[model samples]
Target: MKHLPTSVKCVALLAAALLPLAASQAHAATIHTQGSIQYVCSGVGQGSLQKMQAQAAKFNLGFWMVKGPQGEYLANVPVKVMQNGKTVAKFTAGGPLCYLKAPAGTYTIEGRHDGQLRTIQAQSGTTAHYLRW
Candidate 1:
Protein backbone atom coordinates (compact mmCIF):
# COMPACT_ATOMS: atom_id res chain seq x y z
CA MET A 1 0.00 0.00 0.00
CA LYS A 2 1.29 3.44 -0.95
CA HIS A 3 0.82 6.40 1.52
CA LEU A 4 0.01 9.86 0.27
CA PRO A 5 2.70 12.52 0.97
CA THR A 6 2.10 14.87 3.95
CA SER A 7 2.02 17.96 1.66
CA VAL A 8 -0.51 16.32 -0.65
CA LYS A 9 -2.74 15.44 2.29
CA CYS A 10 -2.58 18.97 3.64
CA VAL A 11 -3.44 20.44 0.22
CA ALA A 12 -6.40 18.13 -0.13
CA LEU A 13 -7.76 19.09 3.30
CA LEU A 14 -7.37 22.79 2.62
CA ALA A 15 -9.16 22.51 -0.70
CA ALA A 16 -12.05 20.73 0.94
CA ALA A 17 -12.35 23.39 3.64
CA LEU A 18 -12.25 26.18 1.07
CA LEU A 19 -14.86 24.71 -1.24
CA PRO A 20 -17.77 26.32 0.58
CA LEU A 21 -16.03 29.67 0.73
CA ALA A 22 -15.38 29.63 -2.99
CA ALA A 23 -18.94 28.65 -3.76
CA SER A 24 -20.38 31.40 -1.55
CA GLN A 25 -18.24 34.03 -3.21
CA ALA A 26 -19.38 32.97 -6.63
CA HIS A 27 -23.04 32.95 -5.57
CA ALA A 28 -23.00 36.37 -4.01
CA ALA A 29 -25.30 38.81 -5.80
CA THR A 30 -24.59 42.51 -5.77
CA ILE A 31 -27.53 44.89 -5.50
CA HIS A 32 -27.51 47.76 -7.95
CA THR A 33 -29.89 50.49 -9.15
CA GLN A 34 -30.60 50.91 -12.81
CA GLY A 35 -30.92 54.68 -12.80
CA SER A 36 -31.10 57.71 -10.51
CA ILE A 37 -34.37 58.87 -8.94
CA GLN A 38 -36.29 61.08 -11.40
CA TYR A 39 -39.89 61.19 -10.29
CA VAL A 40 -41.67 64.50 -10.84
CA CYS A 41 -43.35 66.15 -7.92
CA SER A 42 -47.02 66.08 -8.58
CA GLY A 43 -47.41 66.15 -4.85
CA VAL A 44 -45.01 65.76 -1.94
CA GLY A 45 -41.69 64.88 -3.50
CA GLN A 46 -38.18 64.02 -2.46
CA GLY A 47 -34.99 64.62 -4.38
CA SER A 48 -34.24 62.75 -7.55
CA LEU A 49 -34.19 59.00 -6.90
CA GLN A 50 -31.51 58.96 -9.55
CA LYS A 51 -29.23 60.88 -7.27
CA MET A 52 -29.79 58.43 -4.45
CA GLN A 53 -29.01 55.59 -6.78
CA ALA A 54 -25.79 57.27 -7.72
CA GLN A 55 -24.94 57.89 -4.11
CA ALA A 56 -25.70 54.34 -3.07
CA ALA A 57 -23.17 53.14 -5.59
CA LYS A 58 -20.41 54.44 -3.39
CA PHE A 59 -21.33 51.86 -0.76
CA ASN A 60 -22.30 49.16 -3.21
CA LEU A 61 -25.81 49.45 -1.89
CA GLY A 62 -29.25 49.39 -3.46
CA PHE A 63 -31.40 52.55 -3.51
CA TRP A 64 -35.02 53.47 -4.13
CA MET A 65 -37.17 56.57 -3.61
CA VAL A 66 -40.63 56.33 -2.16
CA LYS A 67 -43.71 58.43 -2.89
CA GLY A 68 -44.80 60.81 -0.22
CA PRO A 69 -48.35 60.87 1.03
CA GLN A 70 -50.70 63.48 -0.44
CA GLY A 71 -48.61 66.65 -0.08
CA GLU A 72 -45.36 65.68 1.58
CA TYR A 73 -41.84 65.39 0.27
CA LEU A 74 -38.64 63.77 1.37
CA ALA A 75 -36.37 66.70 0.95
CA ASN A 76 -33.13 67.73 2.53
CA VAL A 77 -33.08 64.66 4.68
CA PRO A 78 -29.71 63.65 6.06
CA VAL A 79 -28.94 60.38 7.73
CA LYS A 80 -25.78 59.54 9.61
CA VAL A 81 -25.30 56.07 10.96
CA MET A 82 -22.17 55.54 12.98
CA GLN A 83 -20.81 52.69 15.00
CA ASN A 84 -18.76 55.22 16.98
CA GLY A 85 -18.25 58.53 15.14
CA LYS A 86 -17.18 56.42 12.23
CA THR A 87 -19.99 56.81 9.73
CA VAL A 88 -21.13 53.36 8.72
CA ALA A 89 -23.74 54.79 6.40
CA LYS A 90 -24.67 58.31 5.41
CA PHE A 91 -27.71 59.15 3.37
CA THR A 92 -27.67 62.46 1.57
CA ALA A 93 -30.71 64.63 1.10
CA GLY A 94 -33.38 63.62 -1.43
CA GLY A 95 -35.02 60.41 -0.45
CA PRO A 96 -38.39 59.24 0.70
CA LEU A 97 -37.06 55.85 0.03
CA CYS A 98 -36.85 52.26 1.16
CA TYR A 99 -34.30 49.51 1.18
CA LEU A 100 -35.59 46.26 -0.26
CA LYS A 101 -32.63 44.12 0.64
CA ALA A 102 -29.67 44.65 2.93
CA PRO A 103 -26.73 42.61 4.05
CA ALA A 104 -26.97 40.48 7.17
CA GLY A 105 -26.11 42.73 10.12
CA THR A 106 -27.45 45.17 12.65
CA TYR A 107 -27.70 48.76 11.48
CA THR A 108 -29.05 52.03 12.79
CA ILE A 109 -31.02 53.98 10.19
CA GLU A 110 -31.98 57.58 10.70
CA GLY A 111 -33.78 60.20 8.64
CA ARG A 112 -33.88 63.84 9.57
CA HIS A 113 -34.83 67.08 7.92
CA ASP A 114 -37.45 69.83 8.25
CA GLY A 115 -37.81 69.26 12.00
CA GLN A 116 -38.76 65.64 11.74
CA LEU A 117 -36.46 62.84 12.75
CA ARG A 118 -37.10 59.15 12.32
CA THR A 119 -34.78 56.30 13.12
CA ILE A 120 -35.08 52.57 13.04
CA GLN A 121 -33.13 49.34 13.22
CA ALA A 122 -32.26 47.60 9.97
CA GLN A 123 -31.92 43.86 9.56
CA SER A 124 -30.74 41.69 6.77
CA GLY A 125 -33.05 41.23 3.79
CA THR A 126 -35.59 43.43 5.44
CA THR A 127 -37.53 46.31 3.99
CA ALA A 128 -36.95 49.78 5.45
CA HIS A 129 -39.56 52.33 4.45
CA TYR A 130 -39.06 56.09 4.49
CA LEU A 131 -41.99 58.49 4.26
CA ARG A 132 -41.38 62.01 3.03
CA TRP A 133 -42.54 65.11 4.82
Candidate 2:
Protein backbone atom coordinates (compact mmCIF):
# COMPACT_ATOMS: atom_id res chain seq x y z
CA MET A 1 0.00 0.00 0.00
CA LYS A 2 1.29 3.48 -0.80
CA HIS A 3 1.30 5.65 2.34
CA LEU A 4 0.88 9.44 2.37
CA PRO A 5 3.15 11.58 4.59
CA THR A 6 1.63 12.93 7.85
CA SER A 7 1.62 16.52 6.56
CA VAL A 8 -0.08 15.51 3.26
CA LYS A 9 -2.69 13.49 5.13
CA CYS A 10 -3.44 16.44 7.40
CA VAL A 11 -3.77 18.82 4.44
CA ALA A 12 -6.14 16.45 2.66
CA LEU A 13 -8.34 16.17 5.76
CA LEU A 14 -8.41 19.97 6.13
CA ALA A 15 -9.36 20.42 2.48
CA ALA A 16 -12.22 17.98 2.85
CA ALA A 17 -13.43 19.71 6.01
CA LEU A 18 -13.41 23.12 4.27
CA LEU A 19 -15.26 22.00 1.12
CA PRO A 20 -18.74 22.60 2.55
CA LEU A 21 -17.71 26.03 3.85
CA ALA A 22 -16.44 27.03 0.45
CA ALA A 23 -19.71 25.95 -1.23
CA SER A 24 -21.84 27.79 1.34
CA GLN A 25 -19.77 30.94 0.92
CA ALA A 26 -20.33 30.74 -2.84
CA HIS A 27 -24.10 30.84 -2.33
CA ALA A 28 -24.11 34.62 -2.12
CA ALA A 29 -26.09 35.90 -5.07
CA THR A 30 -26.08 38.97 -7.30
CA ILE A 31 -28.62 40.42 -9.72
CA HIS A 32 -27.41 40.61 -13.31
CA THR A 33 -29.29 41.73 -16.47
CA GLN A 34 -31.92 43.54 -14.41
CA GLY A 35 -32.79 46.93 -15.88
CA SER A 36 -35.16 49.84 -15.30
CA ILE A 37 -36.37 53.07 -17.07
CA GLN A 38 -37.18 56.51 -15.72
CA TYR A 39 -38.91 59.55 -17.28
CA VAL A 40 -38.11 63.18 -16.71
CA CYS A 41 -40.34 65.77 -18.44
CA SER A 42 -39.29 69.28 -17.66
CA GLY A 43 -40.37 72.39 -19.59
CA VAL A 44 -42.51 75.51 -19.31
CA GLY A 45 -46.21 75.75 -20.17
CA GLN A 46 -48.51 72.87 -21.22
CA GLY A 47 -46.69 72.10 -24.45
CA SER A 48 -43.88 70.28 -22.73
CA LEU A 49 -46.26 68.40 -20.46
CA GLN A 50 -48.48 67.36 -23.33
CA LYS A 51 -45.63 66.25 -25.54
CA MET A 52 -43.86 64.37 -22.80
CA GLN A 53 -46.98 62.57 -21.65
CA ALA A 54 -47.93 61.81 -25.22
CA GLN A 55 -44.57 60.28 -25.93
CA ALA A 56 -44.61 58.26 -22.73
CA ALA A 57 -48.00 56.73 -23.50
CA LYS A 58 -47.11 56.25 -27.16
CA PHE A 59 -44.53 53.68 -25.99
CA ASN A 60 -47.08 51.80 -23.85
CA LEU A 61 -45.13 51.94 -20.61
CA GLY A 62 -46.32 51.97 -17.00
CA PHE A 63 -45.61 55.06 -14.90
CA TRP A 64 -46.82 57.37 -12.16
CA MET A 65 -47.73 61.05 -12.58
CA VAL A 66 -48.43 63.70 -9.98
CA LYS A 67 -49.51 67.25 -10.68
CA GLY A 68 -47.37 69.84 -8.94
CA PRO A 69 -47.82 73.47 -8.11
CA GLN A 70 -47.80 76.09 -10.91
CA GLY A 71 -48.38 73.46 -13.64
CA GLU A 72 -45.26 71.41 -12.80
CA TYR A 73 -45.46 67.63 -13.01
CA LEU A 74 -43.69 64.37 -12.05
CA ALA A 75 -44.18 60.99 -13.75
CA ASN A 76 -42.62 57.50 -13.94
CA VAL A 77 -43.61 55.34 -16.94
CA PRO A 78 -42.52 51.72 -17.32
CA VAL A 79 -42.24 50.03 -20.70
CA LYS A 80 -45.27 47.94 -21.61
CA VAL A 81 -45.11 44.15 -21.84
CA MET A 82 -47.06 42.42 -24.63
CA GLN A 83 -47.58 39.12 -26.40
CA ASN A 84 -48.96 38.81 -29.98
CA GLY A 85 -49.79 42.53 -30.27
CA LYS A 86 -52.14 42.82 -27.32
CA THR A 87 -51.94 44.81 -24.11
CA VAL A 88 -51.67 42.55 -21.02
CA ALA A 89 -51.60 45.30 -18.43
CA LYS A 90 -52.67 48.96 -18.25
CA PHE A 91 -51.46 51.77 -16.03
CA THR A 92 -53.42 54.73 -14.74
CA ALA A 93 -51.18 57.79 -15.03
CA GLY A 94 -52.31 60.92 -13.21
CA GLY A 95 -52.94 62.28 -9.73
CA PRO A 96 -53.90 59.67 -7.10
CA LEU A 97 -51.19 57.44 -8.45
CA CYS A 98 -50.83 53.64 -8.99
CA TYR A 99 -48.08 51.24 -10.06
CA LEU A 100 -47.74 47.84 -11.80
CA LYS A 101 -44.86 45.36 -11.89
CA ALA A 102 -45.04 43.09 -14.92
CA PRO A 103 -43.00 40.25 -16.39
CA ALA A 104 -40.69 40.92 -19.33
CA GLY A 105 -42.37 41.28 -22.78
CA THR A 106 -43.61 43.75 -25.43
CA TYR A 107 -46.96 45.55 -25.28
CA THR A 108 -49.06 48.55 -26.36
CA ILE A 109 -49.92 51.03 -23.60
CA GLU A 110 -52.47 53.81 -24.05
CA GLY A 111 -53.93 56.39 -21.67
CA ARG A 112 -56.12 59.47 -21.93
CA HIS A 113 -54.95 62.66 -20.28
CA ASP A 114 -56.69 65.95 -21.04
CA GLY A 115 -58.31 64.66 -24.24
CA GLN A 116 -55.00 63.35 -25.70
CA LEU A 117 -53.72 59.80 -26.10
CA ARG A 118 -50.44 58.30 -24.88
CA THR A 119 -49.47 54.99 -26.47
CA ILE A 120 -46.24 53.07 -26.84
CA GLN A 121 -44.41 49.75 -26.53
CA ALA A 122 -43.54 48.50 -23.07
CA GLN A 123 -41.01 45.87 -22.08
CA SER A 124 -40.16 44.07 -18.88
CA GLY A 125 -38.93 46.24 -16.03
CA THR A 126 -37.87 49.02 -18.37
CA THR A 127 -38.01 52.69 -17.48
CA ALA A 128 -38.84 55.21 -20.25
CA HIS A 129 -38.51 58.97 -19.95
CA TYR A 130 -40.03 61.84 -21.93
CA LEU A 131 -39.50 65.61 -22.11
CA ARG A 132 -41.87 68.30 -23.34
CA TRP A 133 -40.84 71.13 -25.68
Candidate 3:
Protein backbone atom coordinates (compact mmCIF):
# COMPACT_ATOMS: atom_id res chain seq x y z
CA MET A 1 0.00 0.00 0.00
CA LYS A 2 1.22 3.50 -0.81
CA HIS A 3 0.86 6.36 1.66
CA LEU A 4 0.90 10.11 1.21
CA PRO A 5 4.19 11.85 1.93
CA THR A 6 4.59 13.71 5.25
CA SER A 7 4.82 17.10 3.50
CA VAL A 8 1.71 16.44 1.45
CA LYS A 9 -0.17 15.32 4.54
CA CYS A 10 0.91 18.45 6.43
CA VAL A 11 -0.21 20.71 3.61
CA ALA A 12 -3.58 18.99 3.44
CA LEU A 13 -4.05 19.36 7.17
CA LEU A 14 -3.18 23.04 7.04
CA ALA A 15 -5.61 23.64 4.23
CA ALA A 16 -8.35 21.80 6.06
CA ALA A 17 -7.72 23.85 9.20
CA LEU A 18 -7.97 27.08 7.27
CA LEU A 19 -11.04 26.08 5.27
CA PRO A 20 -13.41 28.09 7.41
CA LEU A 21 -11.43 31.31 7.11
CA ALA A 22 -10.53 30.78 3.49
CA ALA A 23 -13.98 29.73 2.34
CA SER A 24 -15.86 32.63 3.94
CA GLN A 25 -15.61 35.76 1.83
CA ALA A 26 -18.90 37.44 2.60
CA HIS A 27 -21.41 37.79 5.42
CA ALA A 28 -24.68 39.28 6.72
CA ALA A 29 -23.38 42.05 8.91
CA THR A 30 -25.38 45.19 9.53
CA ILE A 31 -24.13 48.07 7.42
CA HIS A 32 -23.59 51.18 9.46
CA THR A 33 -23.34 54.64 8.01
CA GLN A 34 -21.39 57.68 9.07
CA GLY A 35 -22.67 60.73 7.29
CA SER A 36 -21.98 59.82 3.66
CA ILE A 37 -19.88 56.76 4.35
CA GLN A 38 -21.17 53.23 4.86
CA TYR A 39 -19.35 50.37 6.53
CA VAL A 40 -19.61 46.89 8.07
CA CYS A 41 -17.43 45.29 10.70
CA SER A 42 -18.07 41.57 10.87
CA GLY A 43 -16.06 38.30 10.59
CA VAL A 44 -16.13 36.67 13.99
CA GLY A 45 -17.63 33.40 12.85
CA GLN A 46 -17.95 31.35 9.68
CA GLY A 47 -21.42 32.73 9.02
CA SER A 48 -20.42 36.32 9.65
CA LEU A 49 -17.24 35.92 7.66
CA GLN A 50 -19.14 34.59 4.69
CA LYS A 51 -21.56 37.47 4.87
CA MET A 52 -18.86 40.10 5.27
CA GLN A 53 -16.90 38.68 2.37
CA ALA A 54 -19.97 39.00 0.18
CA GLN A 55 -20.58 42.54 1.31
CA ALA A 56 -16.94 43.59 1.00
CA ALA A 57 -17.02 44.12 -2.75
CA LYS A 58 -19.61 46.86 -2.40
CA PHE A 59 -17.25 48.85 -0.22
CA ASN A 60 -14.15 50.69 -1.39
CA LEU A 61 -11.81 49.74 1.40
CA GLY A 62 -11.39 46.86 3.81
CA PHE A 63 -9.38 46.04 6.95
CA TRP A 64 -8.25 42.92 8.74
CA MET A 65 -6.88 43.16 12.28
CA VAL A 66 -4.01 40.83 12.87
CA LYS A 67 -1.21 40.30 15.42
CA GLY A 68 1.99 38.38 15.95
CA PRO A 69 3.89 36.20 13.53
CA GLN A 70 1.23 33.53 13.64
CA GLY A 71 -1.36 36.10 12.51
CA GLU A 72 -3.86 35.89 15.31
CA TYR A 73 -7.06 37.84 14.86
CA LEU A 74 -8.09 40.84 16.93
CA ALA A 75 -11.60 42.13 17.58
CA ASN A 76 -13.50 45.27 18.53
CA VAL A 77 -10.60 47.43 17.41
CA PRO A 78 -10.85 51.20 17.34
CA VAL A 79 -10.81 52.46 13.76
CA LYS A 80 -10.68 55.86 12.15
CA VAL A 81 -10.97 56.54 8.44
CA MET A 82 -9.61 59.95 7.56
CA GLN A 83 -9.80 61.91 4.34
CA ASN A 84 -7.93 65.15 3.78
CA GLY A 85 -7.67 66.49 7.33
CA LYS A 86 -11.03 65.39 8.67
CA THR A 87 -12.34 62.08 9.91
CA VAL A 88 -14.95 60.60 7.61
CA ALA A 89 -15.66 57.56 9.73
CA LYS A 90 -14.78 56.27 13.17
CA PHE A 91 -16.02 53.33 15.19
CA THR A 92 -15.11 50.36 17.35
CA ALA A 93 -14.87 47.42 14.98
CA GLY A 94 -17.58 44.79 15.30
CA GLY A 95 -15.12 42.07 14.40
CA PRO A 96 -11.73 41.34 12.83
CA LEU A 97 -12.80 42.16 9.29
CA CYS A 98 -14.37 45.48 8.34
CA TYR A 99 -15.25 47.17 5.06
CA LEU A 100 -15.78 50.84 4.26
CA LYS A 101 -17.66 52.51 1.49
CA ALA A 102 -16.20 55.94 0.90
CA PRO A 103 -15.91 58.31 -2.01
CA ALA A 104 -13.16 57.66 -4.54
CA GLY A 105 -10.18 59.34 -2.96
CA THR A 106 -7.06 58.78 -0.91
CA TYR A 107 -7.67 58.09 2.77
CA THR A 108 -5.82 57.14 5.88
CA ILE A 109 -7.08 54.17 7.84
CA GLU A 110 -6.02 54.01 11.46
CA GLY A 111 -6.46 51.31 14.07
CA ARG A 112 -5.67 51.60 17.77
CA HIS A 113 -4.97 48.56 19.89
CA ASP A 114 -3.45 48.39 23.35
CA GLY A 115 -2.53 52.04 23.08
CA GLN A 116 -0.51 51.39 19.94
CA LEU A 117 -1.78 53.09 16.83
CA ARG A 118 -1.22 51.81 13.31
CA THR A 119 -2.06 53.62 10.10
CA ILE A 120 -2.21 52.76 6.42
CA GLN A 121 -3.05 54.61 3.23
CA ALA A 122 -5.87 53.41 1.03
CA GLN A 123 -7.29 54.46 -2.29
CA SER A 124 -11.07 54.27 -2.08
CA GLY A 125 -11.64 51.32 -4.39
CA THR A 126 -8.36 49.42 -4.32
CA THR A 127 -6.94 48.76 -0.93
CA ALA A 128 -7.20 46.14 1.77
CA HIS A 129 -5.00 46.72 4.82
CA TYR A 130 -4.03 44.25 7.47
CA LEU A 131 -3.39 46.09 10.71
CA ARG A 132 -0.73 44.13 12.50
CA TRP A 133 0.67 45.09 15.87
42-130: candidate 1 lDDT, tens digit per residue: 11233234443443433422223333566344544566544334455564644344443334465565666666766655554444344
Encode model 2's per-residue lDDT on 1-133: one tens digit a residue: 1499888899999999999988754442211121342323233243444544444442333443333344345343332323567545443333212223445566455555454455555564554522211
Question: Which is the better candidate, 1 or 2, if ranked by lDDT?
Answer: 1
lDDT of 3 by residue, 1-133 (tens): 1398988888988989988875543335778999888988875675677667766678888878988899888988999989997999899997888888888899888999999999988887774688899
Clashes of each: 7, 20, 10
Off by over 4 Å in 1: 1-71, 83-86, 98-102, 131-133
- TM-score leaderboard ranking: 3, 1, 2
Clashes by residue pair, model 1: 36-49, 36-50, 37-49, 37-50, 44-72, 66-96, 72-133
* Stretches > 4 Å off in candidate 2: 1-71, 74-83, 94-98, 130-133
The candidates, ranked best first by lDDT, are 3, 1, 2
For residue 105, model 3's alpha carbon misses the true position, in angstroms, by 0.5
Candidate maximizing TM-score: 3
Q: Rate the local accuracy (lDDT) of all candidates.
A: 0.46, 0.43, 0.83
TM-score of 1: 0.39
Which residue runs does candidate 3 get wrong by more than 4 Å?
Answer: 1-27
